[model samples]
Target: MELTKEQLAFFDTFGFIKLSGLLKADITWITEEFEAVFPMLEEKHDGSKRTMIVPFADQREKLCSLVDDPRIAGIAKSLLGDDFNYMGSDGNYYTGDTGWHRDGENRARRHVKIALYLDALDGSSGALRVIPGSHRLDDKFGVDVKRVSQSQTALHVAGPDVPAVALDVVPGDVLVFDHNLFHASFGGSTHRRMFTLNLCERFGEDALDELRAYILLHAHFKREHYYGSAMLRSAGPERRVHLEQVDALCGDYAERTKDLPELPLKALI
Candidate 1:
């Protein structure tokens, strides 16, 4: 449950990293589960008649469970101490516009936010945008509330011209970043846009096993559909995924780090 020197360096400079296919099934389950509840939340429509803002808390625990993945939980433990709380949890939809903003607090103490993508994405497809190295700046520079329709900039920084990562998540991939890093996302491919959040009050362990298994299953499911076959890989010329074994394939991720820091066990949101 430790981060390598490279990962620490990347996080220190870039403010984020893109791990493709990190949590597939968990991603899909959360997305599908939230979409089912999206209609119940207050929907603000845009010019195209699509929901602009649909933040609901009815089933936040379900989505939050996806964030508590042990692997990701491990990352949090490695960076932040093992004493924190799940600050908040909910789902956000951006079929239209999302203003630029930071998820960090304005206080002197530092904090971070981790986002998990539920599907594939690219820069043009309303992918999550981030400002590299911005997390090191002061809280004011780290957080801005100007609220641009598509652009994300804090109070002092120039309009978000920073190199933003596309976050082409393959279902299981998770994006761990500092809240101070400016970020935004918009509509893309008519596909569902979903991600989970793990904001800390201090920092602690996460449910890596449950989280990792969910992601893997999600990716496995998608591959089966895309290739028009089932099986992680077939025994024939065109390898196919055997869907039957997918459910049984969730990895054996027992919580091994008893020494890891302990966070508030309260449910997210």
Candidate 2:
């Protein structure tokens, strides 16, 4: 299940790669789990706006084991190194258009997201679009793309009109991209089903403080722990490697966020 050298090169050069039907065989159960998770949440999606849950896969044992799946693990190992950390997961039911934006501007360590879209989509139907090579912030091209993307009105064009590659996908396809890559979606339905696994290169001791700060961002989701009980309970040695670093820091995370006031889901959105 390892990525071919050509595939690796494509991802490194363009900032994203789509592995079509990679999860086809497992999509049935995968979709079942996805549908099942929403009901377990305290808040329900009334279709007015986006609804999201953090630590999504951790809610179901089978989904938690997705990290250990060879297809997924191999991709992470290939892109971020064998010791990459599993940062977190999020499940979503999206509403309309999403403006072009990067998930992060990480200069210290490379981070990648593996996305699973549970329904069919194309450029005209809310498929993911990315500006090629925009992930490399250090590059001049990336810098200019970021500038133009942030100010589309200057060119008299709107978001969907921006020049980019549309990555059309179906139930079993997997889309992987750099965290710093600028991406957006357009013409989507109200209930677009999707989830993502976020992973990053293992941080060194020098970057522990930065890592902790990043963890605190989870407070936006009102998350006390980065992972759920099922994920922790189901992790074997192989899976534990990805979880250990963040697990060791949870004590500090809890203490720091203990006083943060809880807000309603819609308010957070």
Which candidate wins on TM-score?
2
* Residues 107-193 of candidate 1: C-alpha lDDT, one tens digit per residue: 433456666555567666666777676676554544332233234333333333444555655566777888766676655644445
Error of 1 at 110 (Å): 3.1
Off by over 4 Å in 1: 42-61, 105-107, 139-163, 186-192, 201-269
Q: What is the TM-score of each candidate against the true structure?
A: 0.57, 0.95
RMSD of each: 14.2, 1.7
Q: Cα deviation of 203 in candidate 1 (Å)?
A: 9.4
The local distance difference test score of each candidate is 0.47, 0.87
lDDT of 2 by residue, 1-269 (tens): 78999999998899999999999999999999999988865677877788887778988999998999999999999998898999989889998888889999999889999999999999989999999999999899877777656656666678888899999999999999999999999999989999999999999988887887888876554446778878889999999999998888888665676676543344225
Look at candidate 2 and give me any clashing residue pairs.
Answer: none
Worst 10 residues of 1 by lDDT: 220-229
Model 1: number of backbone collisions:
28
- After superposing candidate 2, which stretches have Cα over 4 Å from the reference? 259-268
